[model samples]
Target chain A: MNFQGIFSMSRKDLTTLVIFSIVVLALPIWLQPFGAAYPDLMQKFAIFGILAIGFNILFGLTGYLSFGHAAFLGVGSYTAVWTFKLFSMNPIPALIFAVILSGLFALLIGYVSLRRSGIYFSILTLAFAQMSYNLAYSVLTPITNGETGLQLEAGDPRVLDSMFVAEEAGLPVSNFFGIEMSGIPGFYFCAIFLILGFFITQRIFASPFGMMLRGIKSNQTRMNYTGFNTRPYTLTAFVISGMYAGLAGGLMAVTDPLAGAERMQWTASGEIVLMTILGGVGTLVGPVIGAWLIKYFENIFSSFNESVLHNLFGFLPDGVEGFVVELTSMFVGEGWHLTLGLVFVLVVTFLPGGMMEGYRRITTLFTGGGGDGDKKAKADDTQTQPAE
Target chain B: MDAIFLQFLNGLDKGGAYALIALGLTLVFGTLGVVNFAHGALFMLGAFCAVTLRKILTMQKVVLDEENLTAWGTPTEIRTTYVETWFGDFGTQLVNYSVPLAILLAIPVMLVVGVVMERGLIKHFYRRPHAEQILVTFGLAIVLQEIIKHYFGANPIPQPMPSNLAGAADIGVMMGMDPNIIVYPWWRLVYFAFSVIVIGAVFAFLQFTTFGMVVRAGMADRETVGLIGIDIDKRFTAMFGLAAVVAGVAGVMYTPLLPPDYHLGMDFLVLTFVVVVVGGMGSLPGAVLAGFMLGILQSFASMTEIKAIIPGIDQIIIYLVAVIILLVRPRGLLGRKGVMES
Candidate 1:
């Protein structure tokens, strides 16, 4: 209940937190050897992780399933790009502007959408996202640059103290405080921001506000009866989460300087929701893990071709081998979506607590598994018990 | 006045599509309490049925036509095949004049698919959270679309209308206006008529039939119906299939108006959902009415005058209407008490 209470947590909690932090810190190093290009995948994971974290604050804590979070991400990306075009090429100012812009957009959207809950809310968010996507694709062409996307123009005057000419080939021109910010340096910058985001989220989760949000999630009626204005709390969480999404979007553009209307699409919003759910809703680290897993699959699966399949299936006999390869190929490469869908179905239906629960179960298994099973059974029994 | 009439006609065609798709969505939602994200995919499958039927109808066998040597100076074996090899001779003959025939074919196939989907995938998800239901259905939709795309490439395949109905009808001349003023496509008119028939049939079936009575009872309260010893799940599955058939039939007829593509269902999916919500979540008649109103409003929003006043109004019109409806009547125009809450 107190800040110091969380900070001075039990040894078990402290150890778990420390272990998670170490794993996150070392994840890039562990992932570096699939090729020198693997860090790019890691950077993508971090960016999506940031977005998913923001999304969880609303979805996991408030039980509001938004199907339009991508609009905030798009808004953030666009604002960041615009900031770079008009004010400064520095990432900080662009990120700040993006967060502020996204927060404002989220405030407006959340207010209207939150009026109805459940499927209605989902549909509302989806409609708004679709509208945003359509406008970006056509009506807001001047701002969004239509379908071509927002890109760096060499002719734009930079008001920043630092001078760095736009790069013509390979990557965008970037000089961060007179040091080049291309390739690995750019990725590290994103990584630093992601770490900062995690820290902020960690603080939020351990705060009284987080407790209030959990209360709202559990019973809005009770909170209302207790004389608390539930709307402001929900609205605040929505805006904060929106700002986080904006920050992620800004980072995305900073790492790879382009903002496309597709970023605001309903599908994009769905992807984040999938990430949050896949990672383990209501858990601080679940979304990040889910984001990494999905991004890993996206990048790695797309790169798989016939040769890769053949090599992987080399041990099998000639006739059956070809069939096996064909079947596997159907669910890989271009067929990776099938696998993703199946994973989602399986997780939601069978493992509703998500990957984090699996991890928790494993940990429990190692430390006196017998008592854990009884506890779980009791929990399930309680869940099925009659409500008062 | 002519421009207005033509726009009205266009609105009717578009409204026909919204009504059909929204009707299907509402039926499934009403009976099963599932949001069915894959409804669009089912629509896409229905359109693909036309493409499949056409392919089957066109299969041929080669035959020698030596008598044609009078023109070429040499005898040649002209390749000809029996269309029946693909769809049976009856199907081939019907294909020539067969937009209606395609509708008939699409119905059974789409119905089977709908029933199978409901039984195999959706049945398991009835008690799951809305999010899970959405995710699974969304996955199913993606899988269905990808399978279609894999079988038929990513391009839109245009299906020809029946030859007699191919040309545009000169309605302006009949109305004592300039001949070129307002011409409506015959196929589109036919589609509108077909939609009306289907809509009428569905309403009639629900209103008059004993089976419809049972289904209506189930939709009103599944538990009550179940307690009375009716197999609600089976009936729900039937309703799901019926919804699929409606959507598929709409898609099949819509081929001449818009080419069938893998992504066509997705394009209509969001708009149709909005219509269903606006109509009041489980009300069928409300869905049909909202579909037409939104359709006309959308078309009107696309007008030059409206565009001049506010940009992108056409795209956002339905959503704006939905927001307004929610604000004014959160349960939608005809939503029953306690329906939209869950």
Candidate 2:
């Protein structure tokens, strides 16, 4: 199929895609004021954006909450790193291998886990992920290299690369042809993939399969009674999301060719869930925005210390300034997680649909429910409205 | 033979802890129909209750003595706990028994915490999807643990068991076996015995009391019981408090075995969920049964014989068993019909 045939975007969707691409590509310029322009943090934004967008496919659409998505990510990273070690330092083959291996892993897990729904499915996924993490840290030490993590050794042969060219002096870095996947170039590489991932997610969201997943989420029994077998639909969504996670993991390895078991930890999985919820569950732009917000907080907000807080509160009187700084410091720097927790709770409690709902509410409040406001409201509604 | 016996004892001790935590989890699930991811945080809070009491009991005043300063050519500082300064040996003994005394503090504190959490947060989420409930509670758990970290720092705070019960007891001799074959910590036995009593008391309170009857009825059918004019919501709030206390005391007693840390709750959270699932959701006896069974199985998996065959069985045994059980028997071991099966 041609690109247009695959996506078949409407005018509004095309506008949304164009706007989203511009915002993502211009992140370096836009985020400069916020002190997040550096490539490392920007790469994280793109990478986690991909993760959250993929997660939204299964979670937001199908409402099948998999608490073990991180396992696929870890698998991807391991596969990518192994690809670098055994075959080549080239990123193309590494990412392909990463996505394929993690998809196979997800297929095995999703087949068993999708049999149950709700919290049972959550538990099953959590179990499989934990098992993977445990084995990675112990029994799979030869493959994973245990707690010290898998890193490229200086003398290790890149079999495929060595076949083509003379081996480099030091440990070889991952590259696309000769272009090193690091710094600004690396961020662009990840950003391009993020845009591609977003495009795919957008197409999926607007497709009939997306409608079927939503139908299953609304009422699986009704969908079944309507002569639809929802299992393959859910499983396909699961594998697709898993592949997305794998792609993100592959990107992580491409930028920094080290893979740790920590990426597969349950808490890491929780963080993914938190990002999707913090954005807006079913909305297209929500997860990307959520991932960016969280990555910003994690990188920029966490860098604030007592001295920075003091400077910010320097205008106040001595006693008051000290108290204010102390209070604010607890929510930033080492305590940024506390802020994350607070924000997440507030989002879930007040804005169940997340930041997208908040935006929709603000638009309606200002526009008085007419003209552009009506169209925007209707679009948001179609995305998130509970099925009748 | 001795190794197996010791492993069995270790399993029971571990199982006791598992059962205590799972009992409260299943209790809240049965009563409130809320999936409280913060229940583990309550357990962590209960453990911190002991840490707090110890900190308060050992609050010291420093006195500078000018005459005792030859080494540094400055006044020597002498520190004495306020309790020691006032109550002498009795204060010292109180500090030693801080872990047990924490139960008293945990009961009331956890009760208040549980009630507030249910009324303030979980009550609002009852009508929401189980996913939302899990998300909110998970957020609360992070907040609670972070607050604890802010106050106590991230390191594990060791709570001393009573001085007399500090040493390991030779169980082999008592059981008519060779001496020195099976040595077990005295405190672990105490923990096991205490968990049994607590579990029994919770069961009896529900089985016998009128209040318990109402709560049980509410669990069976909240709307029907509400129609009968019994304030089921209030009782559920109370049951949430009761579950908190059970979890709290379990945490308090567990301090000696594993030092209290901000991350303690999170570590136990996944394992307890597995235990609860294996036992069957909302089944008290099933949770307790599954808790002990998995704990024992985990202990056995950690054995050299088992590890030789399975390698990392000890690390993933509970989750492995949970996956198998959940796939084979979707309702869990003792699950009731039509509860979360859909």
Candidate 3:
């Protein structure tokens, strides 16, 4: 339990990191069998995976639930889109600008929001985020382009556009040097960023800074009593997490080259919270896993209409099949939100550590399940930090 | 000058609704120490109660009118509401007053919903963290909203104002000013009056009644009340129901102003929570005061002169005020020290 050197991963940690990288890199093929290996869905999984990981840095470690994290994502998207609109079609400059701008935005928001803790902190962040969203939709229309969103057009001032070749048909796709950032290439690009994000997140967990954050989460009052200034640490975590969100947003735009104001809505912010909770809050890989699971379900389960249900239950008797499909359809397709809501309630009630805890319980089923008393202690530990 | 007066009137009614919503929110916070994120959902349900009642009262049956002929020379079919068919003129009057009638339906409906919500789900999370309460309630809110959406679809379903009260009231003339200069929508004025009555009644109930006294006492000290041989848990649960009733009635009255949509609850939930926070968490009077203040501020910000001077301020003014208030006075204007901070 010794604090490790900066940038150094222990043997076990390194093994996990490598395994994660391999799995992520091989997702294009591995996920294909699960019927979710399409490039577009893969891209979303990677992009959102990065966003959720960043969110965990603040929420999991510091116990600050930011209901406005979507604002930063929006800020990142707008910045990226503006870069594409004004400068070039290249994603590098757009992404860099996005990260820096959103980092600064988060810095200002965090500085203000971190002035208070608990519900006050949450409300403050929400207020700022809401303001940003409202402005993006209305007054900042010149910058955000209002409801139509910021999209690349046929003729624009792309000063750096001459370096890249335009496509023969339709709008030009975002590129990394000359490689088109669409289809499979886009997934790999996003996957690479996710891996890098995960790696950095792992480092933060092992570092002294991460411990300080954990200390803040466990007891800010005690930390203050012990003479540690918790504000700076928390703010720093907030900024880093914001930048991570910005990077994810940038990646999203890089793949699609569109930025909409709805992306900054409170519901969008709630999605990451749901993702974190569903996977395993504070866990190293839980948020990522959660993100993958949700994105997968949203893509896959939401597509299951009554027809799909009928097809799947075709082997059953006509009356029973019809009845079953009618009932099951309520949990799929447009009813996905209901399913998600039910899952959230159930998970928060029964599995506080989310799906990760469930996984652990099943794995340890033959090993006495750690027994009741020992399991409670472990559960409490995981409750505080779902992932190490 | 008249425009300003009209804006003030506009803000007052809106503020009244905000106050009512915030008052219920603060009630739950005060009594149960749980943030009921689904409070707005209750409000939406209340509004839909009006819609549902109207739909029921106006349920139609088509019959062929042999005396009337269509353009094609076939018998014309006339659709008459069953209420109209059964009760005649009285039923038509009933349909016209469905919004008011919905209050009666919403009272018991909301109480049941609130009790079931508390007993079925929220009861278990009493000992858990505030974060869990928020998450569970938020999820429940979403679920409720989605169910409503499943039944009614996502469109905003407008509830009608009674024909007699649909026009503008010329307050300017009544106040010795130019006629029609300070006119306000009659329904809005009625909403304001209704809100005041509701707010007054709630305060009076808490101020005068024994049940209110017990609830207030429970709010101040839970264990002490329980220690003294009173089952304060049931009282608190009732208080939660009361809060739900308050939110529901507010929503029921507000249907004529803003149409009820699935997302309506969440939309109001954020602003109402802001009002709760800015008023100072768990502070009822503060919630009411902050609600009115923010509502007025929002109206003022939306003024053309104000918007021309500070573009986009209209959209963000309430949130901006929230940010400022939270930073300057984290305990809120009427919030107690070390309430949620501890």
Candidate 4:
């Protein structure tokens, strides 16, 4: 309960907290213009935002680069679904079950993976994640339900339903006590968790513990030489990040109760990595922003087909419109993934510090290009403490 | 006893592919110190080469046959491939063996791709962090796979084995055992033999050639090799090409077994990385040994008897092996200490 000391915040951090709160609260208001007003899209942004933020703690700070984070996410989803199946449709127990199970899973995986550093650690985590996915899709069908996935069935003896009394007509929806965990209410519920996740991550970033992780990232040998045991620090970070992923997964189930084996696939993990790097690795607000942007585009912009493109470019001459549509077709519609890949390449190749660095550079150029001024100092601090 | 023997053979067959992929990965890691996540994409490209070659070879010309008009009042059209027009029966035979013939195109294509990837993108990240290398290469892999997906669509295209080598071969007879009882697929045996030859050739090339020796020297000590005035960079680039060719050929040959899909490369990538790590990073022999060992272990784990005893062991055996090996031997089975530890 005394998390204040862990998340000791400066005045600037408080301002960031206020700003983040405003933006998240404004999502239901201003986001409608951007085509993300719908509850499903809004919930996804919050869910994936949590996923990416959790991923950044280990990758952005410690630089462990576990390719297995999705396994924890998947574990969380399964736990939540099982909780729904057996006992309650309440979000609290489901989330708690999901997070705790995922944390334990992360502990087991991180203990072994952290024993080896650098690429080996990444590969080890990947192997474990893949093994989990393969098992879920095949031999563990009794539990994961194989490719069809584990869904709420009619015969599932949800005992708590009789006690709580089912309110809805057909299938049960996840609830916060009695409040339906769907639609606008669901987005708010997910946002609370995302904000909490962000606050916790911010604290970790500002803590002495976070400083040790930075040391591990910058130079593990130096840390080891200075009488620091790096393994425990790394393992702790991995578990924490894994727990964050679990939290995200739990939130996913809270919003939508289906748990699929594909959720554990390496590509899902890769997307987490992409979100962090694409947004701004090491910058706390960067990954959440990245997750929001990607989900926004994937759900909204990708829906716009050639007709949308034609309408956007209709002001051009008939011949020019045709040419523009043809040229841009490679980056939109069914080609959105191509755009994602290209963005990833360009970001890694040209913008290694990610969009956060780009923002900083532009601000520095505009505000302090003539000299090292207030903007420059602010940018440096932002890089050091990357959270909202 | 016979089941065990069959499992052993199956293990060796699987190991052949694993060893080939791992060897190429370890080679690149040794020579360039780049952890290429795009290696699997290169393998996928190689398999597609066979598909491309067949498509090119069987490009047909349609002609209407007025003399053979149908009852529906339409002329029957005769379709003939360009290759058939040029070389007749020989062209038809070549199409039948397009998988092997793809090697010719795959080697050159893979080499070019490797060179371009290294010269254009990877060279900049040599002094960067391992994370950067991984991120850049991973992005590259995604780009490459997406491009493949864009053109090929998202389905696995099954490739046919050669007509002559389509059925089972009696290896038991050669080994002085009962023939039909211990038969195995001819193509799998061919694949094993092909992998052996390729592996042997790679080792021999490294041992015998001046280029390989210098590359090996560079892998041992890049600064020392550079200070001694050997153009290690060129050799490193060439080694990348060689590694690409190896993976490409492996993929090309494997089309009949796994089928060619845009995603096939990724499915294998995780498993191959495990093999590379378990074998020991930067150690070629270690990669080969671990590949075979894991391959055998995987086959054993997948057995119905084994699964009955230890359910789902088939899915997790490689990871379990990797975890145990890494915890016990931190540097891997044959890896030297402090190679990439920094």
2 or 3, which is superior by lDDT? Answer: 2
- Report, for every candidate in turn, its global Cα lDDT versus the true structure: 0.83, 0.91, 0.89, 0.87
Please provide TM-scores, in order, for all candidate models, with all chains considered together.
Answer: 0.92, 0.97, 0.96, 0.94
> lDDT tens string, model 3, B22-81?
999999889988878889999888888888889899899989988999999989998889
Better model by TM-score: candidate 2 vs candidate 3: 2
Clashes of 3: 2
Residue-level lDDT for A83 in candidate 4: 94
Summarize candidate 3's per-residue lDDT along A1-388 as a digit string, tens digits. Answer: 4455544679878998999999999998898789988999999999999999999999999999998999999999999988988888889999999999999999999999998888778778888988899999999999899999999886767778755554345677788888999999999988999999999999899888999999999998999999998999999999999999999999989999999999999989988899999999999999999999999999887998988898899999999998999878778899899889988888887787888888887677756655566875767654431210
Between candidates 1 and 3, the one scoring higher on DockQ is 3
Ranking by lDDT: 2, 3, 4, 1
For residues B82-105, write the lDDT of model 2, one tens digit per residue.
998899999989988989998999
DockQ of each: 0.41, 0.56, 0.57, 0.47
RMSD of each: 4.1, 2.9, 3.1, 3.6
| Clashing residue pairs in candidate 3 (N, C-alpha, C atoms within 3 angstroms) | A282-A387, A283-A387
Q: Model 4: how far is B59 from its true place, Å?
A: 1.2
Best by DockQ: 3
Model 2 TM-score, 2 decimals: 0.97
Give the alpha carbon lDDT tens digit for every residue of A1-388 in model 4. 3867645688888788779978987898998777669898888888998899889999999888888889999999999999999988989989898989999999998887887888878888998899899889888899888988888877778888767685455788887878999999999999998888888888788888999999998998899999999988888888888988998888888888888989999988888999999889899899988898788777755786899999999999999999999778767777777778778877777777788989979987877566767756765543321111
